[model samples]
Target: MSGESAKGQKSYTNALLRLENITKAFGNTKVLNGVSLTVGAGEFLTLLGSSGCGKTTTLRIIAGLERPDSGRVFLEERDITYSEPNKRDVNTVFQNYALFPHMNVESNVGYSLRIRSVNKVEIKQRVADALRLTRMDEYAKRMPTELSGGQMQRVAIARAIINRPKLLLLDEPLGALDLQLRRRMQIELKRLQRELGIAFIYITHDQEEALNMSDRIAVIRGGLLEQTGGAAEIYDAPRTSYVARFVGSANILRGVSALSSLLPNEIIAVRGENIVMEPYSEQSRGLKGVVTDKRFAGGMLRISARLNQSGAEVVSSRHGIDSPLTPGQSVSVSWDAASEIVVKDNDTGEVS
Candidate 1:
């Protein structure tokens, strides 16, 4: 699902937006520290992380809603670090939708044009085009109060895109919808982006959302970019323990427990999907373990094991196929050596 290879072929000069060493702080607390990133033209790049991790703050900085303490922002090679929001060629879609309750869909979609003193005839045509692009043309006469959450979202998008901005910043715009609705919107949003051929800087804490919709995802932590790559690259080869655990469920084996002389002092990160629970055999390539816990987790059977070599606990999961695994059972845990991700200890500056 990663578009990294496709995006890698392009040159940096073609980036639609660039953030250089962006830093921001609220009083004594630093919210963003030297964050830098780039979004290619028509690419869907997601800023993915937990709350207060600076994803939203970064998006606001790019939108000109919040200025950074230091750093520069470029749009189409033009430095707009201090440009007014209105003058920038960008639009933002927030989580709240922020539509005018008193206005109908057409009026709301054409609000920007109206504020610019555009002719009524031209505004009407643009509004119609925007509404049609979002497939909400039939609901043009409906008020915000009467429209469903999805419909309201469509209307908001129509309004944001009516200006045909160079870049669109979506700040958790789908966070308010139900799970099913949110999933549907994810697909619709991606399709719309491809059709519009405009770059999107989407912000979300949901890993699934980021993987599902992003061409590339930037994982932020402590006001800095922790890792950035396609979903597969980030998942299969996380640069740090934090990213491996945060991006998905992982079983980390450290020190002597990892049983890897190549990185004897480092922590080995193995994803749950990569670990397999099987009967003991001389040909088995991983650590010997004893099953300590087992549970049915939706579609997979999650098994927890304590490694015999170092007594460290590790988790593995298998698809439901009537496995005989049970608590107190002796089982071997094995995985491909290529799947073990080496992560360093940031505090100690050690490989572990």
Candidate 2:
């Protein structure tokens, strides 16, 4: 279990875990449907989806918390499909810090080692090392109630990694924190993963979270893998309408005559930021639309307009906070041909 395998497949020759055609069901509802995934050594891969979309179930299978009805789980060329959780070289950090309320930080972090009958001297050294890695060494004696959300999370991580597991699974580990704190923890987690050189399998339903931390993201929908790629690839060239619509704010144009040369019934998607909005003029080029609504976001002004020809709502974004647009005002919306992507169609819709 501690050795590497040369049989690792695909673009990664050093994958730490592989699940082939994993299937699971509860009663009659199939939670996971032949889902296959691979985590490269020291790579940050996120399983992203909404609730009951099989993301959590997938993570549980990898951690041996839940057994897949069918499929093979491999770790370093060895089949661990039916292996007990304790026998696997993996650890899981759940959203609920799950820290023992009665235990101090140091005790909580060293509990695993103590349970295994590790020598007290070695336990102390490993606990200190894990705490230092997570930057929680200074708070080693603090009680769980005395620590903030982020601090408690660090302690939880320290406990999980104290054994130096080959792979770490995180199930929405930041779901409980506020937005600002969550963002900060996201950075901290990514940095820790890089510093430890341990493969991280993170799970989250938040698109921004996955995009922010993952080296690659696997988007799951309705118990199926929707798309898997880097943040930019998944955003810029989504293979399906669901991915385009779910991953970001997209304006799906279906048979919008104002947009030229569109195939019949073809559904094209354009990111809000990609659409250029300008004041309407007699000679203004591009598709014509009437501004229906405008709102101010963090760094951009989001505008919603109704296409004159197709009556379809198209959203566009303007940088900064200056907006002269009012409801019922006319405007021109256009984007570069290269920026437009075909996501889906009613019949024979193509993706490129």
Best by TM-score: 2
- Candidate 1 overall lDDT versus native: 0.84
lDDT of 2 at 259: 44
**Tens digits of lDDT, candidate 2, 196-301:** 7778899998888988988889998778888899888988888777778777767777655424455445577888888888888989887889999988876768
> What 10-residue stretch in candidate 1 is worst by lDDT?
1-10
Which segments of model 2 are wrong by more than 4 Å? Answer: 1-11, 257-266, 345-352
Q: Estimate the Cα RMSD of every predicted model relative to the unseen true structure.
A: 4.3, 4.0
Give lDDT: candidate 1, residue 283.
Answer: 85
